[model samples]
Target: MDDINAWVWWLVGAAGLGIPLVVTAMPEFGMLSVGAVAAAVAAGLGGGVVLQVLVFVIVSVALIAVVRPVAARHRTQLPELATGIEALKGKQAIVLERVDGSGAGRVKLGGEIWSARSLDGTQAYEVGQEVDVVDIDGATAIVM
Candidate 1:
């Protein structure tokens, strides 16, 4: 019986260490249940309970300490907008329609038609004129 108890405690400690690691590696299933189950097993085994608890605590803390900073740094590095209109900045476009002082015209940018405005507000741009995109206001491009 002593041998069986020792084996059981060893298995419990191994599982206490392994469960958190698996949780850290594959967190899509949610780590709470795995942690709770590991904790319950550690508590029920009784023998080497302190060692098992320490192992679990150490593994959990190590995982958090290592992964949290990487996650934070990655979050900071990602662009705020992933797609759509924000992707059109700095592209060269051609004037498809004359832009008058009223800020009304059409531009062909990225092979797509867009309502356009001039930043200088000077002479109106004629059709077939090439323009540089400065900013986007809704569906309109402020051009130069």
Candidate 2:
């Protein structure tokens, strides 16, 4: 009976850990929350005090080391910004209209039209000149 209880405890802990691992590997599941639940189950099913602490530490550390980087990489692959004309930075654009001292003009970049200004605030950009976008200010790009 004692041996059966120990086996049950170990089986429960293993199942807890294994379920989360399998579920998280699926593209549709979120890993961090799943890992947390797994760690909790491992600790809960560890049977005695020493086993509980050991299982908790081992499961928690393993899950963190394995799952966090995956989540971070997944997050980084998504777009960081949702709006505005900041997409024009570091791209080359052609001046469609001359920009005078007042800093108002139009440019074509990446097959899209954009409002542009000179970064130096002094150069008079002429029509049909290729320029590099250096900064974005609201709807305007500072180009040079």
lDDT (C-alpha, whole model) for all candidates: 0.69, 0.68
Clashing pairs in 1: none
lDDT of 1 by residue, 1-144 (tens): 554544355455556656665867644222333443455566566636575566556555665667667777986896877466667887788998997555689999888899998888886788999888888888889888
The candidate that wins on lDDT is: 1
| Candidate number of the best TM-score | 1
**TM-score (C-alpha, index-matched) for candidate 1:** 0.65
TM-score of each: 0.65, 0.53
